[model samples]
Target chain A: MRPAVRQKLKRRFAETLDLPPSVVLDQAVIHIFGDSEVKIVNHKGLVQYSTACVKTRAVQGLIEVGGSELEIAFFSAQEIKIRGRIRQVMLK
Target chain B: MTQLLWLWWQGYLTVRLRGAGIERLLNRASQVGVALFRVERLTSDVVLVRMAARDFRLLRPLLREAVNGPRISVSVLDRHGLPFVLRRFRRRSFLGVGLGLAVLAVFYLANFVWFVQVFGNQALAVEAIKTAVEDAGLRMGIPRSSLDPARIERKLLESLPDLVWVQVKNRGVRVEVHVVERDEAESGEQRAGHIYAKQDGLVTELLVLQGTAQIREGDTVRKDDLLISGMYYDHQGRRQYGAARGIVKARVWYEAVGEASLVRWEPLRTGRRRSRYLLTVGPLTVPIGRSLPRENHLVTSRTWQLYLGTAMAPVSWTRLDYEEVEWETVPVPAAEAEQNAYELAWESLLAQGVDRERVLVEKRAVENLADGNGIRVTVRVEVLEDIGRFSGQ
Candidate 1:
């Protein structure tokens, strides 16, 4: 399938499950398929989606993500919260 | 303006800053191969950085990155701009530094002298004493630190034999030479002796004032005669030694005759005039007027003094003088010549210290010569007076 259609389907499914509407454009969820990697860019408002794992560039403005278990790493931003078990947060 | 230039040349604006963060900043900049200098950290968040114009431009970008990443503030300063900023920051400190340098310069230029004073003598010259001081290695313009007053006194005494004693003193800037000459003892030499006539003459009169004389009135005596003797014999026939001296008045005679030409050349005054101005420098004078005057006249000169070198006095011009010449003719009469001869004879007697009452004029004659210069005159005179006397005792 097309990466954009896949991203739209994943985002709609997450919203239908009553996770949060913010999850449609605020979440960077990486799904590891068998041979290819998929990044579900939910909260960043990106028009094109990539099928391979890629690093996120610095962005301005606020994006929100809601889930019972969530984890994120912030390098140069403020007010980053992680609700799940903090697996690792390393700074270089 | 001069003061500002002096302050600039003294390296007053050169700033050196030091701190632990400065070392770290320099190391970091060096790692990046950036030519940074004069790095200083005043506080944990404040740092001062200096570099060349090109290097500062290149480091501006990296410095901005460091400011953002390290969360520290940095200021880059040029050499000229640093002094003004630092002066404002520490005004009292800079003023103190400037005053200290001025005081040091004054101390460097000050001249001083250490001297030794010699006193209690009169005949020795002050210059001789100064020469003795110079020989002892103490002289003008020598610093006070190098001179030892006690050592100078010892050396001066060793060098000068005429000085009775010397004392060293360190006056402010001038070495005064006070000297005294050694006094010598008097010798016992006799001052009174026998007086004797220098020539033989007749005793015309008696003008005795002191002591008894052997000769009576109108007695003739020869030279070396004992006119008055202080040798007295006692009743036991022993001669007593004493001072023998006396004055004797005697008659003496001589003759003098003189002849002089009536016509003589004397400088005559001519009513003529000329004036000139001169420019003088030191010993050299250049006349600034015309070389020749309208008439051939005598030139009388006077000198006027100009400026003394570097002294504040008015210029003076004194004219230096001399004269030029010609000859003219004048005539004389025989009566005039005889009168002139009598006048000359009287003047000659007065010049010779002869009493006017003791001279008797007898004859006068005048003769005209063949030359244009006038007549010659001859005069005869006779005088009798007591002319023999003794002068020494």
Candidate 2:
């Protein structure tokens, strides 16, 4: 019922089952193509959007992107594509 | 590829989203599976978003809560998708009817022959084949279905004795008539009797194939002179007539005479020219200039037209250029004119099929005209040729 207890029990169960943490823990998979495009799979939702910046929610933290003319090229329930002059990407 | 076309057919709209909670709107849109794309900030409080036009309808009810504080204004910047375009045509029902009638008319006109082309036919005139085609009811503007090509081919082959083969092909609105003409004379070249000089020349080489050589090398011969005799002498001093065959190579001279006045005319610009611009849409031509140019000037035009795929569209642009030319009299140099006359003579000599490889330049002569005003250049070309002929005895 507690947050630490649930996490410890899930880690023990994952170790016993020999399952990868990314799939078992619902971790987001991020892929970058060149310097202008970023594809984040398993994204939760869009947080903030602007021409200079975009923020999306990942499993562990929030994905913050700084760019010029940033645009959501495409998006669905599973993956989201951000395309433009992507300068920096950080998880905060 | 089909999905991309489907996206276009379903139509996409760039909606200007204006609200303080634009992020919340996007999150909610994605959560509800509306599938928004190409979202970018247009202004401080406004964001331009591209999404399916059909999906925008699902967001209308959700935006009702912010109607007073942050109202949304929707404007159709550009309309895409087939149905939206079709809806515009539906409003103008006459356009649909006119288009349908035009298509039907074009389809009807396609069944008739617009042009007829003849190919691979010699000896038998193209005019004759066209006449034969018309006789078979395959003339211009005739319906294609009324006559058969095979029947026409058969009838043409039967009517024209020279046609060895005939083919009638229907290409679009044009009909192509192909025919092969049969040879009339069989081995006519081998049967000959008299052997005469084809031109005036000095004999350079001579060979008798089946007759007596009448002229020897270095001997001058005139046109129509007997170069080879068609008669052979027997031991009893009697003459026998037969086909005379021989090869006689000779030096043939070609001469051309030309005269020109002391004064010549040269063309110069008059400095007064006119030009105009025109645009055409379909068959309608529209003038886009002050006025047409003056008369007596040459008119040339350059046109650019829009061709979509293989079909030429109605839109076109054209520019016309005009120039005024005036001829002025000038004095001519006698030596240059004489040289030009010599060049012209040489060209004419080559054009007469004179052998250029063995031209006897030493025998060439430049003759003065009797009037003492012009010059004539004669070119003597010595050629080793097969001058053979079968003279019947």
Candidate 3:
């Protein structure tokens, strides 16, 4: 979906249910703990998996995760959890 | 933790997946709803993963998805959980059946009598009672359920009319029969009888239960003398005869003399020793050597044996202890010798049936021997007790 249209639908959906847009939206919610880990929820699937880097397909675009010793702490259709010395998380 | 438990509960398989796209095996397995976990990358072209045992069959067709030949070899590593254990054990069904049959056999055998015991019966013969019990179908090796305790007791009372009271106790695998026999002669009709003195003693108390008292308190009586007369004067001044029953208590006095030598000999160990060992095999004792200890040495043996339950092994180790002892003459003081003689006199008094309890009084005397070679001690103890006996006129 287009970014503008996706934003409008999320806002409307959140307003209709009286809930937070972050919860209603299908966009990847990234949680970064300093340099230790970055957990991405609401993802599509694992596109590339390696020890040094990982590329996950988020609901919006390609989610490139760069870090040292990156391990898939957890992997499922809805969530992709990467742990270990995460240096950067880019969504392009 | 939950993953390990799930693997154990559902049964898992360890397989070696060799290919450049080995990682894809995990992805493809997960896609096929196989739930592969614990993936470890062993090499660039090989990986190991655990999947459900049931999923091993589905992975064969998916081998075509690998980059290389994708050779997969699966060996059953382990089978866990109660269901898998039962499945393996089910192959030998006789073990289960045998265990069940053994339990049932124990239950069935416990209901039958294996041993019968008799108690509290003195005058009644145990063998006669056992025969009667056999007649009642409650003997050894009989079913307890078929025997009624009350009916057996009644049968015993009928067979042996002398039983005043009878009790039957049936326990697991054992039956106990207890009976109290009646004293038919004492309670039945009897002719006249006299109460005589069983021994010489001074009468302390006397009571005639069914006859006239021939002797009163404080009277000295000899053995076989009459204490109660079965012959009594009737109301019309005529002689009559009946059984005599009474209690006669007396204070009996006794004396004993003991002598102790002033110059006596006692055996003392000289500290000289010898030792030997012997082995016993099944009641046959074999000495280790023919060497024996010197003369005048007393030999004592100590043995050690191993036992398992009630059975003892035939192998026994015995060690003999020998010590040389010599009898030496020792001069004993007169006072000590007199004390020793006094103890000997007391022992002799006890041997004559003197009552240790209720001794009214006691006296002792020590005197030098007439030849002046030894000492003599005398002891006398008095006790009050019953001394009545039954006799016929």
Candidate 4:
């Protein structure tokens, strides 16, 4: 990605996440697994982690996980952190 | 940029770190008797501490502890404030202040005259002399160091001829002036043109000089008789008068008997030196010196000084005088006692103007008797001498 586009997306993501924009995500390093745990590390230390075993889906304005409940207010972000049993995974 | 970097390095890092090091150094310094306190940060790395120099020296070794790496440095700044700095060099000793005051007091007292007096005559006006003295720079409140008393006295005598002698004495702050007035002559030079016999007797001898004789030898002349006339005729035989003065001596007779106590008291002089200063003010005199060195003694005479009309200084020189007291005793040889009485009678007659050539001892007798005080002696003497004389008539 271009540096400018990356900076704009980082700002928009920080605004959507309600975190300070001054927070540097550039030093952040991400780890992903197809059906395993997810982890993120920044220059300072570990920032986030998740373990999953659940069915996931993303619709136009909502996301559902294993049809346990449909909570529209909980649907947010391109990258989601999950911590539960994963039945399936879907990306819109 | 390099300069700015150097400044930031030196000013900010080195200086500030050195200041911070001062407190730790002082803390280590005060392990002895000194104490450092009230440290405050002046810069990011700079700190100032107040402590005594002894403590600072004691902590000198710990100052190096603050120099850890090349980036850090240490330095020490004296904590004496502005007021202490201003007063540090201006202290004076108490002795110096006291000496200065004493000198000033002496100088002031030296200029003030403490006493003034005028001496010698009572007729001379004291106030007038005082005024003259003041005009001559010898007044009160004038320093003795600057006054010349002799010159003042000379000037005073120059203007007042009535003063025969003048003297001025200065002792410390007191001044004394002595004056003596001139004496007038006696008035008795107006007897002339007459001559009279001094006594009533027959003249035994006569001697004439520059006068007319009215009586000659063997002439029976009464008292007040004109023995010589001063009036004489000139070349024209006219009467001319002059002073009548002559001396006549004639034989006279007298007898005296006196009794003397064999024992008599006489004063003996003892040589001793005693010094005293006499102060005189006008007619008044006061003795400022010692009265007597010996307590149980008699004073025969004393001398004093006058200033103005009063005595301000008194100096007395006293000597021991012994007085012989007479006492009664048993009678001794009458011959010696009679001789002593004769000598005493001769002395007495001589003092009474008995002519030495004609004086004669007729009878010598002494009766020794006991008296309350001493032995007594009685004697008689006969004296024959010419006792007639004539003065100006």
Better of 2 and 3 by lDDT: 3
TM-score of chain B of 4: 0.36
Best by TM-score: 2
Lowest lDDT 10-mer window, candidate 1 chain B?
A: B184-193
Across B273-392, the per-residue lDDT of candidate 4 in tens digits comes to 455545443234566556663433334554433222332322223333322233334553455555666667667767666666764555555555556432344444444322233345
DockQ ranking from best candidate downward: 2, 3, 1, 4
Residues B1-393, model 1: lDDT tens digits:
553344344323222333223334444444455433322334433445444333334444555556534443344334444345466548678776787775564344233452345555577666777777888878865776786777777877778766656777654443444444443321111333334554465666654443346776687778777665545555697766444444566654323344445654444556444566665432346776655442344666666643223221222354533333444534555567556666776577567655667654455555666784555555554544543343334
Residues B221-304 of candidate 2: C-alpha lDDT, one tens digit per residue: 887788888778767978876667678887666554444444576767777767789987545699986564444456688999
Indicate the docking level reached by candidate 1: incorrect
Q: How far is candidate 4 from the true structure (C-alpha RMSD, Å)?
A: 40.5
Between the candidate structures 1 and 2, which one is better when assessed by DockQ? 2
Fnat, model 4, is 0.00
- Each candidate: what lDDT? 0.47, 0.74, 0.75, 0.49
Residue B250 lDDT in model 2? Answer: 76
Question: What DockQ does each listed candidate score?
Answer: 0.01, 0.49, 0.08, 0.00
Q: Per-residue lDDT of A20-74 in model 2, one digit per residue for the tens?
A: 7667667788888888999998988888888888888987689888889888888
For model 4, the superposed segments whose C-alpha errors exceed 4 Å read: A1-92, B1-202, B219-226, B245-247, B262-313, B317-332, B355-393
Lowest lDDT sum, 10 consecutive residues, model 4 chain B, at: B7-16
Where model 2 places Cα greater than 4 Å from the true spot, the runs are A1-25, A29-37, A64-66, A83-92, B64-78, B121-132, B154-164, B181-393
